[model samples]
Target: MGNKTALYDKHQEMGAKLVDFGGWDMPIHYGSQVDEHHKVRQEAGMFDVSHMTVVDVTGTDAKEYLRYLLANDVAKLQQKGKAMYSGMLNEDAGVIDDLIVYLMTEPGVAGEWFRVVVNCATREKDLRWMSDQTASFDDVALTEQPDLAMVAVQGPKALELAKQSVSESRATLIDQLSVFQGLESEGWFIARTGYTGEDGLEIMLPEDEVADFWQALADAGVSPCGLGARDTLRLEAGMNLYGADMDETVSPLAANMGWTIAWEPQERIFIGREALQAKKEAGISEKLVGLVMESRGVLRAHQKVVVSGVGEGEITSGTFSPTLGCAIAMARVPSATADQAEVDIRGKLVPVRVIRPSFVRNGKKVFD
Candidate 1:
C-alpha cells in the first residue's frame, strides 16, 4: 500500500486506474487517457493535486531567508499576492527542486508571509533543507499545510467553472488575482496558476471538503482527469518533468530552464550562483532541445539521440503526442546540432526533426 491523497476514494469511485506515483497511489486515468487529454485541451477538466506539498513560511525574516534559498530573486515579488517561480539548488549548482512562492497578505497579519508549493516526490527533502536553513535564523517559521487538498480546474472554461465552485469570498478575491497570484479565504486558498497550458485555478481547501468540491465540479460538466492526462498536457505545453527533465544531477541551464534563473541583483548571490555564473561564462557544451520522430515509432526516455555531424545525447522526456498524432520528445543534445537528429528506437536509428518547443497550445498544434 502507498500513501493516498485525500481524493483517493473519490478517484476510485469514479473508476480511476490507480498507479503508484512517487510512493503515492494516484489515479492514472478514469477511462481513456486520450479522451481525458482531449477534454482538457478543448473543454474543461479537473485534477486532484493534493499530493503536492504546500508550506507557509512566516516571520520577519521569511523574505530574506527565501532570497538565500532560491536561485531566483524573491525580492522581485514586492507586492502582496505576487508569485514567482524559482528553483532551489544544491551546492553544485544542480536543481534541487522547482517551486512557486507567493507573497501573501492576511487581514490582521503584519509583516510578509510566503506560501511555497513543491513537488510531491521531493517534499521530504525540500522540507528538511528548509528546516536546516531556518534553524539558525531567528523569527522565521515553516509550517506544512497537510490539512489542505488541492484541485486544479483547467481549460477554456476553467475560470468560469472555478467561480462557481469556490466560496463567494474566495471567488471574489481569486477573481481579482492575476496570473501567478493567490488569495486565501478561511481555510481555502485559490491560486490563478496551473501546470497545464490553459487558464485555470488551483484551489486548496480542507481535506474533508475535497470530495464534495470534486463532485460539484463534475456536476458542473468538468471532466475528471488523472495523472496520465496531466503528463500529456504538460508535455505538450513544453513544461519540464521533475525527475525526467531535471534532477539533482542537472543544472537549470542544462535543462533549458535558464529563464527561471535570476542573474541580476549580483550582490544577492544565492546558492549555486557562482557555479552557474562560471558555466555561463565558459559557454554551454550541451543543451536541452525538442525532437519529433520523423518516421513511425514512439519516442521514449533514455533513447540515444545521435545528431548527424554533431554529437550524441539522450531523450529526457518523450511521449506519443495525442494532439500532434505523432511522437514528441525533449532531449539534451550537443548544442552544435542545428536542424536534425536521430533517435535509437529498438536498435534502429530513427530520424527526428529538432524544433524548439510548445508543440501544442489552446487545443491546436503550434509546431510541426
Candidate 2:
C-alpha cells in the first residue's frame, strides 16, 4: 500500500481508480476522465491535492531570505494575503521546483507571514534544500504543515461552490480575495488559485476534516475529479508539470517558464540569476513549444519531433485535449526550427502545427 491522503476512503467509496503517484495513492479517475475534464470546464469539480507539501517560513528575515532563494522577486508582493509563483533553481539556473508562496496576512501573533506549497514528488528534496538555504539565517523558522490536506475546486462555478463549503466568517474572505491571494482562518488556509484555466480556489484544511468538506462540496454538485483529468486540464491551460515538462537539468527559459523569472531590482541577487542572465544573453538553443496534431493520433511523451527542413525535438507533455477535441502537446524543440514541427505518430511522421500554448481558458478555446 502506498501513502494515502485524508480522502482515501471517500475516493474508494466513489469508485475512483486509485494509482500510486509519487508515493501517494491518488485517484487517477472516478469513471470517465474526459467527462471529468468537461465537468471542470463547464461546471465544478474538486481535486485532492493533499499529496502536495505545505511549508511555512517565519522570521524577521523570511522575506529577505526568500527574495534571494526564489527566482521570482518576492518583493513584488506587497499586499497581505498575496501569493507569488516562483521557481527554485540550482546554481546552473536549472529548475528544481516550481511553487506558490503565500504572504500570510498575520504571522503567529496576527501580523502576516510566508507559506509555500511544493510538489509532492519533490517533497524531501525541497525540504532539504529549503532548510539548507535558510540555515544561516537567524530570524527564520521553516515548518511543514503535515496536518493539512489540500482540495482544489475548479471551473466557472468553482468559487461559488467552495465558498458554500466554508463557514460564514471564512466565506466572506473569498469575496475580497484577488487572484494569487490567500488567507488563513481557523485551521483552513484558502487560496484564490487553481491550475484549470478557470477562476477557482484551493483550500488547505485539517486532514481529518477534509472528507467532510469534500462531502459538502459534492452535495452542492461539485464533481470529484482525479489526476488524469487534472493533468489534461493543466496541460490544456498551458501549465508545466515538474517532472514531465522540467527537471533539474532543464532551465526555466528552456521550459517556457521564463516569465516566472524576475530580472529587475539590479541591487538584489538570487541564486542561479547569473546563470540565467548569461543564458538569456547567449540565447537559448532549444525552447518549449505547443503542438496541435493535424492527424488522428494522441500525442505522448518522448515522441520524436522533426521539423520539415530544420532539426528535431521531443514531446515533453502530451494528451488528447477533451476541450479542444484533438491531440495537443508541449514539446522541447530546437529554437531554430520550432515554428512548425512534425510529430511521429505510429510509424508515420505526421505534420503538426505549432502555436503558443494556453489552448483553453475561461471555458473558451484559445487555439484553432
Q: Candidate 1, TM-score vs. the true structure? A: 0.96
Residue 315 displacement in candidate 1 (angstroms)? 0.4
lDDT of 2 by residue, 206-258 (tens): 99999999999999999999999999999999999999999999989999888
Clashing pairs in model 2, backbone N/Cα/C closer than 3 A: 105-112, 106-111, 106-112, 107-112
lDDT against the true structure, per candidate, is: 0.87, 0.90
Q: Flag regions of model 2 displaced more than 4 Å.
A: 106-112
Candidate 1 local accuracy as lDDT? 0.87
